[model samples]
Target: MKFTDGYWLMRPGFTARYATEVADVRAEADRMTLYAPVKHVVSRGGTLNSPLLTVECWSPAEGVIGVRTTHHAGSVRRGPEFALPGAEQGAGVGKVRRDGEVVELVAGDLALRVDTAQPWKLEFTAGGQVLTSVGERGTGFVTDPAGRHHMLGQLGLGVGELVYGLGERFTPFIRNGQVVDIWQADGGTTSEQAYKNIPFHLTNRGYGVFVNHPGKVSYEVGSESVGQVQFSVEDQTLEYFVVYGPTPKEILRRYTALTGRPALPPAWALGLWLTTSFTTDYDEATVNRFVGGMADRGIPLSVFHFDCFWMRGYQWSDFCWDGETFPDPEGMLARLKEQGLKICLWINPYIAQKSALFEEGRQAGYLVRRPDGSVWQWDLWQPGMALVDFTNPAATAWYIDKLRQLLGQGVDCFKTDFGERIPTEVVWHDGSDPERMHNYYTHLYNRAVFELLEQERGEGEAMLFARSATAGGQQYPVHWGGDCESHFNAMAESLRGGLSLGLSGFGFWSHDIGGFEGTPTPAVFKRWVQFGLLSSHSRLHGSKSYRVPWDYGEEAVEVTREFTLLKHRLAPYLQRAAQQAHATGIPVMRAMVLEFPEDPAAATLDRQYLLGEDLLVAPVFTDDGTVEYYVPEGTWTNLLTGAQLTGPRWIREQHGFHTLPLLARPDSVIPLGADDQHPVSAWADGVELRVHAFADGAERTVEIPRSDGPGRTAAFHLRREGGVVRVTTDSPHAWQLRIGGPDGVLHSYPAGTSEAELRYES
Candidate 1:
């Protein structure tokens, strides 16, 4: 993706044409167009032999400016464009004006300015201050030695600007000085390749850029030009949007508003999920042992997942249970459901040759075919596997019907995996570009299954343990970190990826508890148990070995039990966070930089993250439980212990297996459910509101959502005036009020009290 050999020269076998001064401008109410010749047109003959690049500018939504630069206008457009649901509602909102040499298009508070008299430059500004600019020679049309065209654009990077979020990158959390390609791959947590590749990045300078291309978008973030973030695509045109926000969270809100907000997952899906690990030998008896083991240890297990090998060997995606192992799939699921556990089945979009539905799909023209009209077959994950052509409506319906049969047998959701290993030499049913479909295919594949689940189970109840995604894929809730090794290093890398994905636009995310590649040591498993249980979604999964807590040690079992119980008690707090994600685009698990944008120390920290707006979580990554984390300026109280720490500094401490640094921010009220056995209950029934470090004259209103669905919540109003903390609520259910301090629970109110006033010492 890098085009320059050094700072001054281009690499060999490359030709570049840059857009010069604008020759003419046509202004409209909603958009503006600039005709720029590759050379300066001092004379009329100067424009004769030069390529005239067509630059179009408009606004998709308020505070978002889109610019498209094209070399040829006759290239055939393709299908599989990103779904911008807000574009229609935001139409005709842009205002264009011409002031001397500067022409500006203003949408909301953001404006895009282009100077017709100067060298080609597009400057984005807000409040009359420049956010970023595409400087001279920034818009380019290039050709490689093979005669393929590429269009690229570069935006200026400031001196101390830091870039983040290109879809779950496990490399350094700061993406500056890295070459990133927006291509989906099945590479695990250790590689440069990512399962989710979104061509969007936000900076510390209060703006974000989203390349509106589903195909490959190569980005050189302060790498090629050293002072610019350059992006290129192998096509006739390049379109990207610059979204402006004075804050990082506001930037994400605007970006996600243009794309899509995440769907609110059901409350039970936030509880601990136990999965039969991949490649492990398991049947009904093994599942019963694991489920019963958790119950005996007093651990709350919400959903049970059956990974691959639920079907017969070499017959993946048959949607049929292997009779040799699970002799009674329906009966087994019924018994599990009776024990208050939901069911999840592992599935992918590929149909193996040995599967019963493969022939049916191939005969019905539902499979992707090569140029010669033959099914595109591969032997990578499964023998003779063919991809389902989701572009074909009939194929989507046929595939959904197969899954509907499993839903009939009591499956609650699906682990939609392996949509990253797509082929580019095949033809789609709707004639989409093959190169484009390689990454966009996962969108269709996940949407078809997610929509089916939404139809069967009501809205806010459908969830997927999905692995691969692209831009706007946040509509499908609950994606997990894929295929990590069982080690302390991989655990930290997984946290980095999750935080990065959160900054990208995803709301909820999870990871394998004891890792997925090897058997974790007891220390690793116990530490991961604490980390995983603290994630937005929690799951225990692995490969070749079972992830039962007792397999590691007794301490692991105790650690898993304590955290699972703790997570269940934290359900009301998490549900409110999920509602925030559904309303705005803020993620449940936020990075430190996203929460503390003004703190210089938080710009590069990746080892720790904010669990919600209130609690800061720093996962222990060492075997000895030694962790060093940063806390912003506040008197923060630990939710676990009664320890209070003041910061704007780094704190290093060694914790036992049962605890890590989970601190509640100052002046925050966290809703705690009384029941610690289940995530789904009447959340307002016997709830305890923990008020932490409420400063004088600080007041807050907390809304606890109902467990059944959205739009139903219990409201609690709290105010701290002088010494007495007053609390009032509108719910009829029983509740208690607890004033928390360095010594936990300084004052407690009785149950069934709708209003109370208690005096507390600061």
Candidate 2:
């Protein structure tokens, strides 16, 4: 993807024809077209031999702009294109004016200027200030001898600007000076590869850019060119969107609205999920013992996942219980469900040669084939493995029938894993270009499984513990950060990845609760318990070791119990945030920058995050129990101990094994459900709304949903109106409100209390 030899020289065997200057511009009602030649046009004869690059600009929505530059207009677009929502058609074009070689196009309040002369720049301006600009040689169309095509674009990187989000990246939280390739790989969390590679990045400069392509995009961020962020793809046509957030969170909101907002997963999905560790020997009796042990230890376990070995070792996706191990899968699932637990099974799209479906897929043309007309086979993860050709309708139906049978056996969800190891040399069923199908394969794979879940389970109830995704894959509710080592640094990296993912518009994200590889120490497990429980989704999974709390020690079980119960009690507030993520595109586990962009201290803090809009969680990342977290300008109260703190400063403190710095923002009302042990019905019987440290005469309203309504029911509204705290619960039932601090109790109120006085320490 890097084409430059150094700062000044182009690599050999490639010709660079850069857009030099715009000769003329034609303005229409809804679009502005520019004709820029690659060289100087001294006369009409000069325009005859030079290549005139045609550039088109238009406004799609308020604060959104689209630019398309083309070398050859008549080009065939291949299959496997990203499904982008059409721009709001009412995007009217307004006035156009031209200076010497600079032409400006105005659409509403957004203005785009094409600098034809020096450096051949494309600049976007709002009001009168410059937002961002693309410098000289910023856009190009490329083609290679092998019939491959590409489009390249480079945008300017300003001083002190930081870039974040390209989907669940495990590298440094900030993406500056990193070369990010939008290609999916199973290269575990420690490398430059990523399982979930999204072609989108948001900057601290208050605007976001999303490469509107699902295909593989290679981004050389300040690597190839020192002053620019360059991205290139293999295709004739390339399209991208520049979304004006004005704020980082708003940019994500608009981006998600365009692609697809994430769905709110079922409340039970948020509870602790216990999985039979991968490659561990387990039968029905073992599963029963693990489930019963958690119950006996008083640790709530909501979902029980059976890992890959559930099926025959070599024949995954056979979808049949190993007759030798699980002779009665139906009965086993029934008994587990009766004990109030959901069942999840590990599954992937690959079919091993031993699997019966392999022959069926081979005969039906449902498997990817190489250039020699033979089925593509490999022996990487499984023996003689052949990938499921999800591009084929019959293949997809064939794949879903297997899942439907699992669903019929009482399995609730699936851990849709391993769609990242896609092959680019194989042919797809629909004749999709192999290169284009590389990253997009996961989209089709997850969509098929998610759709089946939606069909089996009703709306708003389906969820997937999916691992790989592309641009529009957020529609499937929950995704987890991939494998990690059992260490503190890995835990911190996972949090950074999760926060970065949230900034990228992914609503729900989880990681292996106690790390996915090697046994974590009791202290590490206990600390991870608190961190995992506070995440948008929580799961206990691993490869070589079990993630059971008791596996570590008795104290680990106690830590799990404390956090799980706390999470269950906090469901009312968490579910509201989940609903917000569904309605708007903001994530519940938000980065510090998203919540407090104006605070300079927040832009670089990746060790902690804002849980929804009110809570700040700084997870302990050291074995010594030390935590360094930042609190924005406010009076924040510790949710664990009754400690109050003032900030805009970094606070470093020592935490015990069971506690970390989880703070509630001032002037916020965080609803706490009455139940703690169970999450399935955490919708609340009668909620106790704990109004946090509000300023005197400052009132806040909280919504309390009816118990019978959806998980996100009722709204409680409290506001400081007329120097009085006016409180109203949205539900008709009687709701109780209480005010308490480090000193015992302050006051209490009934549901119908229309007005109340603010209580504070005298």
Candidate 3:
């Protein structure tokens, strides 16, 4: 990906060309086209010999500009395009000035300057201040030794600036000085993420550069030149979008509007999800005991997940329950459903030789094949496993039909796993380049299953416990970090990955509550239980061991019960955050930097996160329960103990079993549901609105969406104005309010309680 030898020389065997001068410019209603020659045409005869690069610029949505530069216009673009959001382009209103050896094109707040002479430079400015620059020989066309052509672009890096978010990277928190290839692979948490994305990074300087490509995008971030971020892909055309933020939140707002925000998952999906351990012994009795044991221990379980053992060994994704273990799956699910629990089973896109449908897929050309016309096989996860070619329409339908059968037999949702182990040596039915299909395959695989879920289940009810993802995978509801060791360090790494993924434009993310690998000790499991229940989606899964709380100890059971109920009680606030994630691109679980950009401590604190912009959750990673956390300049009150602390300083303290560093930001009105007996929906019926640290004149609105349907039907927003806090309702249903602070009891009305009074204790 990096072709530069150093700061001064280009690497051998590579030719770089850049637009030196804008020969002419044409402006339309919402677009601008520039004809720039790589070399200045001294005469009319010179223009005929050199290639004129065509750079077309336009706005996809407000505050986001797209630039498509083409060296050759007639290249064939294959399938596998990113499904970006549709937008209405606004009219342009800037001036274009051209002078000898210099040309400047200005549109609204964006300005681009092109140098006409040697070492061509394209500088982008906002309000007359240089933001980033494209330097000499920075943009060019590349053809690999295999005859694959590609367009490359490099932009100048600024001092002290950092890059973040290329989709679920497991590398360092900051993405600088790294050569990242955007390809989805089954490389675990230890490697540079194979599940890479083209969505570029938003810098600390308040601007983002996103590559508009679904195929493989290789990024050399400060690794090649140490002063430039170079990105390249296989094609003659390069398309990218420059989204202006001026703030990280604004950048995500503009970015998600261009790509699509995630859908808010169902209320039940937020509760604790318990799974029978993968590759462990689990039958009808084991499932019942796990469900019954949680109830016996007062741990409110919502969803029970069956791992790969649900199907016969070596025949995953057959959609048939293992008859030896689960004699009657339909009846078992019916009984579990009678106990008011949801069901999830493991599945993947791989078709094993032992699977019944392998022959069907092989005969129908639904399976991926190598160049020699033989079915590509791998024994990595499963023996003789072949990948389902999701690019083919009939192949997708065939796979969906099997899943539909499982749905009819009582499976609620599927944990779509292992799409990252895609083969790059095979050919897709749609003729997509194999290397490009590596990452793009996940998008198609998840899309097929997600679309099917939406069809079978209702709109808001569809959710996938997905593992792998690419660009635009945020449309799917929940994705969990793949596999991790059952240790405190892995717990922290999982958090780092989630925070990183959230920065990558993903909304809802989950992980194995007690880690996925070996069996966790009581201390680790208890600590992980608290952290897991607080996540957007909580699941207790592991390898070779049961994740049931009592398996560790009674204390672990107690911790699990406390946090699970606490999460159910906090559903009102979490769902609102989820709705915001659906509306904007902001993640439900956001990094501190996303919420507090001005706070230097927030930029480096991956161990802690601002949960839904209100609560700060620093999961205890050590057995000692000592936590070191930072709060932005404000008064933060602990949500559990009501202990208030002043921020802009680091606080280190040891916590108990019932407490962690969960603090609510100043002026935050955190809404809590009343009940934790069932899932979130039942609790949201009568919610208790808890107003925390209501700073005078600092208006804050808490919207609790209706649980039944869409469109934000039933909700309440509290606004503090002129020393009075007003709680207004959007739902016509009657509601009651509670005030807990220095104030005693607020006046409560019927379904629509628009006003309240708190007795201020001064």
Candidate 4:
């Protein structure tokens, strides 16, 4: 992807033609088009032999400029392009002025300028300051020795500028020294590869660059040359959009508006989930033992997942329970529901040859086929597995019908697994380019199952434990890090992957609590229990071994119990974050770089993350329970302990199995839930308000869903000045206030008054 040998030389055997100056300009009502030649046009003969490049500019949405540069306009337009929502049609024309040899097109606060004289340059400015510019020789049509042509664009990267979010990458948080290929792969969390590779990356400088292509895009982020971020695509034209935010969160709000935002997962999905481990012997009795053991130990398990073995071997995704092992699945599921647990069944897009649906799909042209018109089959994961052709409308309908039947039975949700091993040599039914369909297939696959879940359950109640996704796939509720070994290292890698995914525009993320590949040690399991219970969604799953808390040790069960109830008690605060993620595109789990952009220490910190906007969680990564974390400039109070700390600094401390560093941001009000037994609707009952680190002139507002009416809620406002505080609410229920401090809860209100005045010593 890198074509530069040094700062001044091009790679051998690769030819790059640069646009030297604009030869002709055509100004339209809504856009501007230009023709730039690759050399000086001193005479008509000079213009006749030079290569002319076509440059078109338009406004997609407010504060966004879409630019398309073409080398040749005669290339075939292909299918399977990325589905992008239109910004706004027919621009209102804010500013269009031609001064001397420069033409400026302004949309909102973003302006783009092009010089028509010699030394052609395109500069993008926001708020009258240059954000970035495509300088001389920056835009080129490149050709390599292999006879393949590419369109390349090199943008300016400022000093100390770091790029992030090329899509759930596990390499590093700062992408400055990395060469990234925006291609999806089956790589786990251990390598430089990624599962979901979105062709989008933004800088810490408050602007985002989204390559509008579904096919492969290669980005050289300050690696090929010294200070240029270069991107290339193998095509005749390269289209990209420059979006401005002036802030990291605002950048995501605008970017996700162009892509998509995540759906609000159901309230219960946030609680702990226990799964029947893959490749383990599990039946009705074994599953009962695991679920019963959770209840016996007072660990509230909300959703029970059945992994791959739920169906018979070599017959994966038959959408039917194995009759021999689960003869009374309907009755068993009903009984489990009676115990107040939801059910999740594992399903993938693959259909094995032994499955009855394989022939049904293969005959209806519902499977991806070979060039010879035969069904494409593979033997890696399952024997003779074939993929369902999601590009086909009838095949999508056929797949959804099976899920509808399962929903008719008692299945509450599904773990849609494995759309990553898609084949590029096969042919799609709808004539989509197979290579482009490789990553976009997961979007269709997840959307089909997610829509069925919404149909069976109500809107805002559907959820999926998915594994594969591309850009805009965040509309599905939840996704987990795939296939990791059970160890401290894998736990840390999963955290890095999840944090990267959160920055990549995913709202909710989860992972195997105790790892997924091998059996974890009791220490690792217990530590991961604390980390997993704190995630947006938590699930205990592994391969070749059960993930039951007691299986590790007695202490592991206690650790699971301690954190499960803690998360249940924190649901009110967590749900508010989820609602915000659904409204905006910000994530429930955020990287420190996104929240504390001003702090230099937070830019590269991956061991800790911010849960929503207020809580900072640092998962103890060491076996000795020692952790080091950084706090931005403020007085932060530990949510569990009343102890408080101040910094713009790092602190190291050792914790027991029951505690980790969960800090509340200064001047914040966190609503603590009442019931530990249920999470769906008990948030309002007996809710306790925890007020943390209030300073003079600090204001806080807390709200919790009311237990009584439809869409009803209760709210309270607290304003603090030194030792005196004011409280106000208009709810009929009684609530208690815990004035958090090092000493303890100084005062507790027995009954709620409309207005109260109180004084407490800090």
Report residue 471 deviation for candidate 2 (angstroms): 0.5
Off by over 4 Å in 1: 741-743, 746-752
lDDT of 4 by residue, 557-622 (tens): 889998888888889888888888988989999999889887778888889999989999999988
In candidate 1, residue 296 scores what lDDT? 92
lDDT of 3 by residue, 1-762 (tens): 866567676667665666776677675555668787888777988788777888887766655667788988986777677777644334453355667666566655666666655455678888778888887556677655455676888888899888888887777888889888887777666677645354567777778888988767889898887888889988888999777777888888877777778877887898889999897788899999999999888888889999999889988667788899999899999999998899998999988899988898999999999999999998887788899988899999999999999899888898998887677788889999776677778888888998898999989888999998887889887999888889998888888888888887888989898888899989899899888888999999998888998889888888899898899888878887888898887998998889988877778778999789888999998888898888789788888877788879999989987899898788777777767766556434566766776766666656676656565545567766655667666656555554433243544466555555554221
TM-score, candidate number 4: 0.97
Q: After superposition, how far is residue 9 of candidate 4 from its true place, in Å?
A: 3.7
Whichever of 3 and 4 has more lDDT, that candidate is 4
lDDT of 1 by residue, 1-762 (tens): 877788778789988898978999999998999998888788777868779999999998889999999999999988779988867688887899999988999999999999898888899999999999997758978898888899999999999999999998899999999999999999999999999999999999999999999999999998888899999999999999998887999999999998899999988898999999999889999999999999999888999999988999999989889999999999999999999999999999999999988999999999999999999998998899999999999999999999999999999999999899899998899999999999999999999999999999988779999999999999998899999999999999999999999989999999999999999999999999999999999999999988999999898889999999889889999988988999899999999999999999999999999898999999999988899999899888898885889988899999999889999999998888888999888888878778888899989998987755468898999998899888888876778777774355544445456797888554
lDDT of 4 at 143: 93
Query: Candidate 4: misplaced stretches above 4 Å?
Result: 86-95, 707-712, 741-743, 746-752
How many clashing residue pairs are found in candidate 2?
Answer: 14
TM-score, model 2 to reference: 0.95
- In model 3, what lDDT does residue 430 have? 91
List the candidates' TM-scores in order.
0.99, 0.95, 0.93, 0.97
| Candidate 3 wrong stretches, greater than 4 Å | 23-29, 39-52, 87-108, 111-119, 142-150, 196-198, 682-685, 712-754
